[model samples]
Structures are given as structure tokens and as C-alpha cells.
Target: MSVASMLKNNKLSKAICEASWATFKAMIAYKAKWYGKQLVVVAKNFPSSQLCSHCGYQNKDVKHLTLREWQCPNCHTRHDRDVNASINIKNEAVWLLTAGTAGLAY
Candidate 1:
């Protein structure tokens, strides 16, 4: 459902809507530093959800949040949307790390 719909239906609250993502990121950064690890922030518009983790095929048609599961047309692989997104994000991070460009802020 849309954020506006959720807010109207009381499924989402105003405080949550006004929360600062930067504060959350700062908290994660501090925690990661304390643990002697790095925190990587991906670009805001990265298409993690639309990418096929198995074959690196990007399905531009998967733009709606309602699509919770989909099949990769390229590889014919069935995927849970969230699981595929997580894998794609992880792979992207790893690629950035290996390519020696992870430190460059987006």
C-alpha cells in the first residue's frame, strides 16, 4: 500500500513519517566504527528490488511495491522479492569493495 494510504488508515504514524533517516545512518555509522567495521550506504535510487540476483537482469516493470514475488525472465528463476533484493544489495556492496571504490560516497 502507499504511504499516504497507510497514514490515512492509521497503519503509519506521523512520528514515523517525520523520522530522520540521516539520524539512523549516523547511529549505524557510529556503531560500525565502534565495532571496527565499515558502514556502506547504497544510493537512494539503487534498483535493488528490480534486479535479478541470479543473472543480474533488471526488470524495470517491477516498480510497484505490491509485487512481492517474481520470476527472473532471463534465468527463469523464482525469487522472493525481499530475499532477492537483499542478495542484490550484498552483491553490489561486495562488488564495490572488490573494485576499490567502496569508500567513495555516493
Candidate 2:
């Protein structure tokens, strides 16, 4: 979740502000550089949660945040929203790195 959105929630606003996302990202970049590794940031418009990791099918209905679990219409594979998004992110990162367009190679 983006810090801005998290801060919109009254219960989470304080904790979100305390996290200091800018510093966190800086730290991550520093660590990636120190370890000679690349960091990939998927495009903000990428529909990670809506895409089925198993079949590459985009389910527009999954855009509803309340829908946590869904089945791929093309492949009939069940998925947990967050888990599928993570897999999609990893795949996209690898693809970007291999395509010589790493998002943020530190």
C-alpha cells in the first residue's frame, strides 16, 4: 500500500507517518548498492493484483480491494490477491532486468 493511502486511514495514519518511506527507500537503495544488486519498481499502473500469475489473464473484477481471493477465468487457478501480486512483481522485475531496462538498478 502507498504511504498516502495508508495515512488516509485514521487508525494507521500515525504509524504510517512514523515509517518515513523516503528514508526507507533511500536505505533500500543504499543496501542494494552496497550488495551490488538491482532494485525493481513495477509501474504504478501495472495491474499486479488483477492479473492471474498462473495464466496471465487480467480480471477486471479483482480491482475491488474487498475481493481477496479469485479464480482465473482462463486457467481456473485460484489465487490469494497479495500472493499473486508478489509473484507478478517478481516476474516483472526479472523481465525488466533481463530486458536491460531495470527500474532502479542501484
Candidate 3:
């Protein structure tokens, strides 16, 4: 998670500060290194929550946290907010891995 970006919101700033995201990320990095795995860090501002995983449509209306469910206008696919975001994150990581090292070995 991007602590800085999250901290920008007044509602989440305190909770974000208390979450120790830096420590969590450090642990993840350490584990990845120990396991000989490459860690792909996506951009902090990537709109995972707003993007439709099935159709790549950006639903700007889903910006509010209260909207836990949404439908993609482009593909008309119903989506659970968190599920869609996780899928987008996974897709982005896979894309980054392939595009960043197209000719290189893992």
C-alpha cells in the first residue's frame, strides 16, 4: 500500500500512520529476497479500485469508499470493489514482469 497517497486523505491519515506499512513492505521485500523472488512494485497512483479488471474501463464514480460494489459500463460486468482491485493489481504485476524483462531470465 502507498502510505503517502493514503495519508493524503484526512479520514485515513491516522490509521495509515498506525498501520506500519513501511515495516510491512520491508518484511515483504526481505521475504522476497530470501525466497529468490523478484518483487514488482506498482506505481503508487495506479487506479486499481477504479479500473474494471474485465474491460480496462475507469469508473470514476467508484471513488467513494462507501461504494463497495460497482458495474463496469464498458463490459457491463458486475464487480465487487475489492475483488476487482486485487485482480487489477495481479494483472499489473504480471504485465510489469513481462514488459520490464521481455528478453531476460527470471
Candidate 4:
């Protein structure tokens, strides 16, 4: 709402994110690179949860209770939040490279 309120909220959100970055990054990065899979870190603004990995469908409805678990309504496939996001990030990197838009979109 107000400038101060916005700043306060931003700082709090950023602090929470910083605390989890290492663990999340390590989990995805290591697993991906371990088997010769490219690891990608998409821009933080990318919407992973809202996109369906199986169908390229996007939705606005998000069930917070299933933050770590979800089934894509369009395809009836279950997804693990972090895992799907990581895969999506990797795809994005490859897509960017092929599209000649970015050397590393991640």
C-alpha cells in the first residue's frame, strides 16, 4: 500500500528467499550437473508453478496447500513443485539458447 509498507514487505520476502537459496540451488544444480544435465537458473520472475510442464498450459489459480505438490488439471499429471520448476528452468535455458535471445536465460 504505502511506500514504507512496500519496502518492509519486500525486505521480509527477500530475507526468507535468501535463507533458502543455497539449499534449493544446491539440490537442483547438483542433481542436474551430476548426470551431465545442464543446470539453469531462470530469472526469479519466471512462473513455474503456474505452468504445466506436460502441456504448456498456464493457470492463475494456485492452491497454497499444495505448494510442494500439485496435479495439472489439464493433463492429470502430478508434479513436485521444486522438481518441476527445476526442469522448467533447464528447458528455459535451452530454449533461450536456441532462440538466440540469450546465452543463458537462467
Q: Tens-digit lDDT track for model 4 on 36-62?
A: 765544677788777778886775565
In terms of TM-score, which candidate is stronger, 2 or 3? 2
lDDT values for all models:
0.81, 0.89, 0.86, 0.69
TM-score of candidate 4 on Cα atoms, chains taken together: 0.55
Ranked by TM-score, top first = 1, 2, 3, 4
Task: Name model 2 segments beyond 4 Å from true.
Answer: 1-19
The digit string of per-residue lDDT tens for model 2 on 19-54 reads: 786668789889988998877877879999999999
- Please identify which of the two predictions, 2 or 4, would achieve the higher TM-score against the true structure: 2
Colliding residue pairs in candidate 2? none
Cα-based lDDT at residue 62, candidate 2: 99
Cα deviation in Å at residue 41, candidate 2?
Answer: 1.8
- Clashing pairs counted in every model: 0, 0, 0, 0
In candidate 3 the C-alpha lDDT for residue 22 amounts to 69
Candidate 4 achieves a global lDDT of 0.69
Q: Global lDDT for candidate 1? A: 0.81
Candidate 4 stretches greater than 4 Å from native = 1-41, 63-66, 103-106
Q: Write the per-residue lDDT of candidate 3 for residues 1-106, one digit (tens) a residue.
A: 6768889999999887767876787788788788998778877798999999988999999999999999999999999999999999889889988887422122
Give the TM-scores of the predictions, in the order they appear.
Answer: 0.79, 0.78, 0.77, 0.55
lDDT comparing candidate 3 with the true structure: 0.86
Best by TM-score: 1
The best candidate by lDDT is 2
